[model samples]
Every structure is written in C-alpha cells, then in structure tokens.
Target: MSVYLFFEKKLPFREKKRKVVRWIQYVIEKEGKKSKRINIITTGDREIIKLNKKFLGRSYRTDVISFPMNGGIEIEGEIYISLDTVTENAIQWGVTTREEWRRVVIHGILHLIGYLDNNRDEQRIMKEKEDYYLERFPE
Candidate 1:
C-alpha cells in the first residue's frame, strides 16, 4: 500500500488534516476496497487550473482532479485538489470548508472507482455517491 500526499497550497486548517485522512480511509473501506495504494496531492487554484487544462482539456479552476495510473481495479491513482476552490465552493455552497473538502475527496475517490463525470447521468450518479459517502463519514 502506497499513499503519497503532496501539498502546494497551505491548508486553511492544519488540525483537520488527520481527520481528512481518516475519512478518506473510511470511504475506501466502506467501498470494500482492500488495496490501500492511493496518492493525494493538494495544490492551489493555479496549479489545479493548469492540470484541468492539461488533463481534462478545460481551462477552469476545479476543486479536485483524479488521474488513474493503470485503469485497473487496484486503485492506483493520483488526486489533485485545489484548496482555494474548496474554500470558495464552501462559501458558495453554504457549507463549511471541511465539508466541501470532504465532498471533493469523495468525488475523487469515486472517480478512482470508475465513476465518470463526463455525462449528465454519470455526473448525477457520482454526486449521489459522494453525498452518500460523505454522510457516512465520521465526524
């Protein structure tokens, strides 16, 4: 099991990092995932925007991005998150920043699990799953 965590932008709250990691592990376990090989990277809006343009072909700032390495069921991938967007989205969505961050993490993990956000239906399903796992996350 390999978990790589990279940070580009300072997290708004330092105390919440451990909790976030635990919640991610919980999500993985809830989904019946056994291989704990996952990498999480946090970055600023600029980096995430560049990644969105380079990988997703969209030049916009997004909250999270997932890049799978093998396209297999072993769950080897990279997750890029923008703390700036997470804060802005938290305010826009009327939720706490931590909550929004959890949502983004859940969304990324779902992507690693083969969920696609390219289509309307797929996006809806992914959002539902995100919400479902988020609700089950430990506080």
Candidate 2:
C-alpha cells in the first residue's frame, strides 16, 4: 500500500514527501483501513476545473475531488486537489495555506474511505472529523 503525490502545477507550499505519505497512511490506519494506493495530485484551477467538468459535470474549481478505484475494504483511489482553489480558500477562511491544504487533502482522503458531505449535517460531521484529524497531524 502506498500514497503518491504528483504536482500537476506548482503549489503555494511544499510538503516533505515522506511526511505527507506517512500522515496519509496514518489516517487510513486510524480509520481501521488499508490502501492499495492513493494518488494525490496537486493541480491548478484549470486542470481541476476540467476534471470537475469531465467527471463531476461541474464547470467550476473545487478544493479537492476523489475517485475511488476499488470497492473492497482496502482503499485505492485518485484525489485531485486544486492548489489554486485551496490557496484562495485559505485566505477566505483566514487560515494558513498549509492548514487549508491539509484540510482539503484530509477531506479527499475521507471521501475515499466512504465519508460523505452531501448534506449540511453530513458536512458538519465531515468537518468535525477533519478537524479531529488535523489536530493530531504531525506538526
């Protein structure tokens, strides 16, 4: 099982490759799950917007989008994150870019693990979970 990060474009900040991969693996294990692979791709608004339109049929930028590859207990998927959107969101939310990036990444990972934020209540629950994980993430 492995987590790989690809940069489709330059991001506002950089993450230590090993640290990011280890944290993701930690998140999966904490949820009592395993992964075959998780491809976390950082992209600009244009690429992500294209993906949003092509896959989700939404022609707008989004922080993160996840596509689960397998249906069994072991998780496998691709998560595309819009670095541009995430940077803007950080300013909008009054948080650091890194914080917002972590939240978005964790949000995508959670989606891969079957968490949903389709409704207001679900979004709240998801946010709480995200925060919970965020608090424990390595500093």
Candidate 3:
C-alpha cells in the first residue's frame, strides 16, 4: 500500500506529508478497504477545471475530484485537489485553509472507499464519515 502526494502549486500551509498518508491509510482500512495505491495531486483552479471537464464532463471548479482506477477490495485511485478552491471555500465556510484542505482530502478518500454523496442523504452520511475519521486523526 502506498500514498503519493504531489504539489503543483505553492501550498499556503506546511503539510506533514507522512502524517497525512498515515491518516488516509487508517481511513481506508477502517472503512473496510485495503489500500493499494493512492495518488494525491494538489493544483490550482484552472487545472482542476480542466480535469473536471475532461473526466466528469463538467466545466467548473471543485475542491476535490477522485478517479477510481481499480474496482475491487483494494483501493486504488487518483485524487485531484484544487488548493485555490479550497482556499476560497475555507474563507466562505469560516474555517482555516488547512482544515478545509484536510476535509477535501478525507472527502476524496471516502469516495474511493465506496461512499457516495450525490444526494442529500448520501451527502449527510459522507459528511458523518468524514467527521468520524477527522476526529480520530492524530493531532
């Protein structure tokens, strides 16, 4: 199992890369999915918009976009995160940028583990899982 993180844009806060990876691993295992490989790419809004358009057929900016590479017991995927959008969302949501970044990361991981948030009920459940994992994250 492996978690790779790439930063395309200058991040506003310092990230404990190893800690984040461990947190993801824990979340995957806790959710009953064995982690195989997960790639996290942090980029700007333009890149995220392009990816969203290319993969999801939507031309817009989002905080996170997840692509499931393999479907099985093992969790494998690419999670693209838009730091620009995260920052904007943090300001609007009254949360710190780091907190918003963590939320986005956890949200992507949840998607890879078979959690869906397309509707209100699913979104609420996903949010609950995100909160559950976030609360357990080592400080």
How many residue pairs collide in each prediction? 0, 0, 0
Q: Which portions of model 3 show Cα errors greater than 4 Å?
A: none
Q: How much lDDT does candidate 1 score?
A: 0.80
Report RMSD for candidate 1.
2.0
- Lowest lDDT sum, 10 consecutive residues, model 3, at 130-139
The TM-score of candidate 2 is 0.95
TM-score of 1: 0.85
Question: Which one wins on TM-score?
Answer: 3
Better-scoring candidate (TM-score), 1 or 3: 3
Query: What lDDT does each candidate get?
Result: 0.80, 0.90, 0.91
Ranked candidates, highest TM-score first: 3, 2, 1
List the candidates' TM-scores in order.
0.85, 0.95, 0.97
- Predicted candidate 2 versus true structure: per-residue lDDT over 98-121, tens digit per residue: 999999999999999998999999
